[model samples]
Target: MEHKNTPIYNAHSYHTKVPPQGIAPCILHYTDPGDLILDPFCGSGMTGVAALMCAHPPAEALHLVHDARLGPRYAILNDLSPAATHIT
Candidate 1:
């Protein structure tokens, strides 16, 4: 679940970042294809990344996903910090 070394996690420096890999499983579990996800405190847009990842999950992640909805979910990300929003 830790993604400190992943490319997406390393792509930016955000204090509140939650790795997309860690978030993806939950997204895949709770939502179906074409669902809309809203992240009010999005940092570096990791949740958005996770939502997209659900569409074409890697082979390694297939085992973790419980649902059969293997399609893209839309995301709306927001952050109070201008820098965070820009990065997202």
Candidate 2:
């Protein structure tokens, strides 16, 4: 992908159909190898995967706030939606 041509904006993967290709360039430009990056939503962990592929170790953390009964900040949020999680 052309780094300069692609638009940089906050958008969800489901709506834009643009897989997280933009992540690689962003990481390459601003961060060094082994630098930590966080993707709070991490729909499919694509940003983390890209970081790994680029030789940067990534620590992925997902925060799911949809279930009010479970309350926020619950780690179970990560486990509840396996289908929505992909780590490459």
Candidate 3:
């Protein structure tokens, strides 16, 4: 069965939710096997997952930045806070 093309913003399936389904063909078009793709923001880890699904090894570098006030203000508080630790 063929998967229907849906807007990336609206779909909830893993293929749609994680990676913009429309971009799969684009990825295949531009990238060869094992190429490294980078998504700096990496919100929800979608791009990495998308690269893996396309038979790429997944993006090699990921930098996650969380808001500071949401968690910790100093070294000690950061170490103790789960949100801060997640950032680390």
Per-residue lDDT of model 3, residues 36-65, tens digit only: 665544443434434554542223211111
* Model number with the top TM-score: 1
What ranges in model 3 sit over 4 Å off? 1-20, 56-88
What does the lDDT read for residue 8 in candidate 1? 80
Compose the digit string of candidate 2's lDDT tens values, residues 1-88.
Answer: 3332333323223332233445555555555555667655655555654565454321221121121121111111122345555422
Candidate 2, residue 2: Cα displacement in angstroms equals 8.8
Tell me the spans in candidate 1 whose CA falls farther than 4 Å from its real position. Answer: none
Question: What is the C-alpha lDDT profile of model 1 across 5-82, one tens digit per residue?
Answer: 988889989876788877887888889989999999897899999899988976556778755578899999998989
Ranking by TM-score: 1, 2, 3
Per-prediction count of colliding residue pairs? 0, 0, 0
Worst ten in a row by lDDT for model 1: 59-68
Instruction: Give TM-scores for every candidate, taking all chains together and pairing residue i with residue i.
Output: 0.88, 0.45, 0.39
Question: How displaced is residue 79 in candidate 3, in Å?
Answer: 19
Q: Per lDDT, what order, best first?
A: 1, 2, 3
| Clash-forming residue pairs, model 1 | none
Model 1 CA lDDT for position 65: 70
lDDT values for all models: 0.84, 0.40, 0.37
RMSD each, Å? 1.5, 13.7, 15.2
